[model samples]
Target chain A: MYQKSPTQEWTSNVVRYKKFSGSWAWLLHRITGLGLTAYILVHINTLASLQEGPEAFNAKMQVFMQPHWIFAAWILFGLVLYHTLNGIRIVIIDFGKGAKYHKQLLYGAVVIGLIVFLWMGYIMFFGHAEYDFLSMIVTSYN
Target chain B: MSYKYIGSRGSGSMSWFLQRISGIVLVFVMVGHFILMHYNPEMGHSFNRVFERMQNPYYQMLQIAFVVLALYHGLQGVWNIYRDFKFPSWLNMAVLAILIVVGVGFGALGIANILHF
Candidate 1:
């Protein structure tokens, strides 16, 4: 239960709230959910270029293939990965006896999410023929 | 008299169940999507590749279904979050209408893109 003094304001109340780990998970899930939903709308609009023929579509796709865009896409994948993993945890909690071990489930999700995120980053950015700079970094380090 | 929107939904058992079901389905689809689209960035990023893939009627159908299901799930999730706060019933109804309109509008756009090939 949150008590707000007359001067405290809603933002201050939230800023002062003592958040547990689960609260962070809950908040992140909501933030990512809303963001992904908005993104899907834009994604559909972007795909509408398909009707304009190959020249038009390829031009647009080429822009996205740039390194900056790839970086952005990789971040988007991270959010999607978190949402998907946590979603499974939620289902387990609701349908099975996971409530008792919910914290463990959250930990498991984070661990797995981090590993996959790194793996995906490798796939997206590292050891790339097109990304000569990235490949150069790897070789130079080796 | 406040119509008490909470009671009208009957605990939202159906939406909750549907949300779980949709989430489960999305996990599988997302795996395939990532593998197919990002495995070789060219596999999905290029117009030629996408055009070729869209030639398959079955792929087109599946993609259309993916669009519909994704929009439905996302919008429903948003509505769930919206419901957590205390808003008047009129505002709630207005938001529901806007979400439906957005889903339908973008759904049509997505389907049209997939089917264009």
Candidate 2:
């Protein structure tokens, strides 16, 4: 058995965890930003292809609608949810919400990210576009 | 801005600026994108509609501009994240060079795809 003092071990772990948390937040933000940006490039360019004809447009659209792209879509969607929620958390912290409240807000951000990610997952998987706000009223309970 | 209050305008400052600018652009782009893709997807999603839009010289120009800006902004943000890790200076520069090359290469391919189509 490793016989390190518990107090020393605990303190070291706390410092390590703190470093990890900050790095994790920074890393997630960067990754999400990149994914979202790639999506933007593909999106605008693909839309630009509409100039060719419906056949060309459908071919491009099919690429995006494929299974692999759908998976990428979910991942990018989740990243967006996390990045935006965590960004708002950072903004709150920046505005002088300090000490205990800041940590509390960070936890709140994680919860919000999870919720939004689940919603996105459901929508992406469903294939139907009913999840869009305006579409629901017209399609359902009319 | 005072030196103490203002942050270093080195890599960090540049990265910060790029992220903010790109994020702002995305807000407009994302909303427009979703509307075009999902709202009346059947109509707007057609290639002919896309061709019509791109056929407009102004839209074509804007599309090119948008691609360049998006790639620059995103790659810069990624570079900033990579820089956050303390690495050897040479390694940092190499990584940066690679990112630049890849970004530009992708941008070219994307442009070609749009133009040729």
Candidate 3:
């Protein structure tokens, strides 16, 4: 009798399976998908604060505009950017146009993501004095 | 006595198709939303600004549609991931039921908030 061992199965499924570009892309897609879904649920609840009136909602917004929270917001932005770009890649492949150049598409998505991220990051962190203005209004809205 | 359900396996393709459709819709709606919220923070982040926006029937409709599409896309993605785990049939059904309840609950709450204005 011959049988595969549990450790070997784990290695094959978990370790080696993640080595390729496609696998890495798949893994990142799954992570970003899950993260975005979780964010949507929380976002709805936060928006529901409007039922309590503007003060309540503004209070929540104040917390969200804090420096640490702003960093998290940037990370969330990056995740959505990556997911959206990769999603387009997936759609192109599904349309049967880029199956052979899938690897190139993945790399192309990453390069584009980086470029957009830098541009957005600069605006978010520097180009907008209005970011501060908005935070002030949110904090003082009550 | 025993019973079995027929054609339980046919939903996979339907879900796959729906996910892609919802993803395309989300890409447009979400990018619009992000630009509105971040690119124009002064107009988007103020309580008065949001209140004003929600007052418009068209804006409310857009928000409601966004919520519905997002919930469907997100819940479908989560369900697809769970399917890969090969859970037992009974547990799978339980998970699906829970996901449905949560998805519908959030969607209703979101729509109600939009309509509240």
Candidate 4:
């Protein structure tokens, strides 16, 4: 008879290495990938509303344009940005192109990802605000 | 634990290759989608605007390709993560079935919508 190990459970193994950057990245990648997949399903279904004509689709768009939904959209944007940047790093690493500078590549990706995230947040909030400063300057020139 | 054969051996390599290819394709399609739909939401979120864009043959083709590629890439990614966990054979089979059903169902819906437009 074969004997089972105490650490054989998936949860235990996941818990053990949860703190490492690599592990955290792996976990987040899976999570965000799953989230994106779910979003794709919802996205397609929502688009299907187009078949019903413009009114129905516009109504759905209005719902999506609500504040909470807009917040969720920003979150989705951040997730995609991170995933895409990290995915490029991963692809490069896979090709043995950046074997020596893997850690630097990851750090670079994180830095870039952070900048994009904050920039996106700024655009989402301040850029669209009533007193929109950036647009004010641009329109003033016009 | 004993294992059951789900399919032919060496399928992992095929999935890995397809994932990379799809990922490359998605980089372009998804980025275009983000710029169009999010960065310029004024036009994208409007039904008439989207309907007008969808009327273009090139845009329709892009949407179809994006739908198919994204579905394949995402489903394969889920399977890859599941494989890492080394789930029991039955559970693996179950997850595979679920991914297939969901992926195909959603992909079909997306393609149908594009065709209808």
lDDT of each: 0.87, 0.64, 0.83, 0.79
For model 3, residues B5-91, the per-residue Cα lDDT tens digits are 211466578887788888888889888887888775566667899988888898888888899998999888988888778666777
Docking class of 3: medium
Q: Every model's DockQ, to 2 decimals? A: 0.81, 0.34, 0.71, 0.66
- Report how closely model 2 matches the true complex, as a DockQ value: 0.34
> Candidate 2 vs candidate 3: which has greater lDDT?
3
Model 2: which residue pairs collide? A50-B47, A50-B50, A50-B51, A51-B50, A51-B51
lDDT of 3 at B104: 93
In model 2, what lDDT does residue A9 have?
92
**Winning candidate number (lDDT):** 1
Error of 1 at B105 (Å): 0.6
Fnat of each prediction? 0.84, 0.40, 0.64, 0.70
Q: Scoring model 1 with DockQ, what do you get?
A: 0.81
Per-residue C-alpha lDDT of model 1 across residues B34-55, encoded as one tens digit per residue: 9999878888878888888888
Candidate 1 lDDT by residue in tens digits, A1-142: 9876777787787888999878988899999999999999989988888889988888999888766788899999999999999999999999999899989999999999999999998898864576554755566579
Error of 3 at B63 (Å): 1.1
- What TM-score does each of the candidates earn? 0.90, 0.62, 0.89, 0.84
lDDT of 3 by residue, A1-142 (tens): 7777998888777865547898889889999999999999998998888888888888888887665676688899999999999898888788668789999999999999999888877766665875663465466665
lDDT per residue as tens, model 4, A77-107: 9888877877887788787677677778878
CAPRI-style docking class of model 2 based on DockQ:
acceptable
B57: Cα error in model 1, Å: 2.0
